[model samples]
Target: MMYKKLFLLSGLVLSLILVGCEFTKKTVNNVNLFTIEDDINLGLQVSQEIANDPKQFPILKEKGNEDVYRYIRKITNKILNSGKVVNRNNFKWQVKIIDDIETLNAFATPGGYIYVYTGLIKYLDSEDQLAGVMGHEIAHADQRHSTKQMTKSGALDLLLSAAIGEKEAVKQVVGGIVGLRFSRTHETEADEYSVRYLCGTDYNAAGAAGFFKKIGGAGSPPEFLSTHPNPDNRVQEIEARAKGMGCRGNSTNKTEYNRIKGLL
Candidate 1:
């Protein structure tokens, strides 16, 4: 009877805790149990894991690759500093380059930790194209899509466990962030936001579609496509949206972009 009473007490405490800190839903579709602080903390934990796992991440050191880092960060900063993103100052907005030349992908952890593979840089034809891709990744984090997806996947129980100081529950949530495949609705939203973010800058607002256009022309699919599932007619849809939004500049900056690509 003692063990049963302890269980009841624990359950009562959890219920009381949740009553004060209930899981809230954003205006967006999914349920997001995490707060902004939670996103930042979780992202930092995942980033530490990536930093420790050199074999898988193989992050390029900034010492020898200062220029490359600067150029990429320039693109990232442009989008973050665009005054369009809501959590612009709240997130870290740091950039890292993964050394793999064959993996054409970039991703952002919640609270703005960005990672780009060297292959993605090399594969793109212009700086604007890279900016487009970066913008999309940024949108995913800014939209809090990862945590929303987690909440839908029955993470509320784990979060409640975490609330009671269960470290392992927190670790499980962190582990799941990296490999998440965003839904088509999230992908479309990211793409649209990418255009909006770049629209305020010099680059073509629809430059992300350029990545899709190039990939469509290629014989095999890119690793980026594996994680970021392309919606049907995505390229056309992005271009049309850019036009409808009256996005102005179309600077590809291919010459300077090519020079930087050689550095990779």
Candidate 2:
């Protein structure tokens, strides 16, 4: 009888080990399953919902602002065509300017839809500064960080359900999980990608450091810092990375920059 009980315990332990291994494998595989196409589709769906919702910010379309749109398109296209992004072929990129002057922010939807607020543009001193901001937003899309966040949220919900032994509790778990902010690691990773993208392109990568410093000292957190690392820390990281790449201060894109600046 003792031997029989011992055998049963051994089998149970093996079963638990197998289950744990499978769960780990699933989580790792799901992380890799995120792709640019998936991100774009998710972004599009979210954007459409936001567009339909009256509470969301209105899409900007001032009569004389066509020039502003054209200027943004020209610069964005130049950066996109630079071939620095590893997954650039996967996106059908689009840029839109928000008319709101008080909101200094920019965000990228999963599908390559990027929105930049007029306030952000007004604060930018040069084209490279604008590119630096846009590049960081693009990096978030390229990395599919949102998808990973969503996946992790779902996984946590499942784990919570199992721990409580009640499927009905999953909704509460999910609600809390969704509200959980991303860790510092994700912000750092995005910053790294942004700098790398800028480095291989015509955009002055070193200018990114200055932009962060300006934003930090501008009496408000940087737009990029809204869902990212602290601006001060980000500036330091950018400065270190830029120095390593041999990029230095006050690089010029003055001609094209002035044209865009005039529109603002």
- Residue 57, model 1: lDDT of 90
Count of backbone clashes for each model?
0, 4
Candidate 1 C-alpha lDDT tens digits along 177-212: 555556656677788899999998888999898898
What is model 2's C-alpha RMSD? Answer: 10.2
Each model's C-alpha lDDT? 0.75, 0.60
Q: By TM-score, how accurate is candidate 1?
A: 0.82
Worst 10-residue lDDT window for candidate 1 reads: 14-23
Give all candidate RMSDs, comma-separated. 7.1, 10.2
lDDT of 1 at 85: 90
Worst 10 residues of 2 by lDDT: 14-23
Which tens-of-lDDT digit does each residue in 19-103 have in candidate 2? 1221233344246334555565555555554455434556777577888888888767766766677668887678888777777
Note the residue pairs that clash in candidate 1: none
Q: Which stretches of candidate 1 lie over 4 Å from their true place?
A: 1-28, 157-175, 217-232
Task: Name the regions of candidate 2 deviating beyond 4 angstroms.
Answer: 1-35, 155-181, 217-223, 226-228, 247-251, 254-259
Report the error of model 2 at residue 256, Å. Answer: 4.3
Candidate 1 global Cα RMSD: 7.1
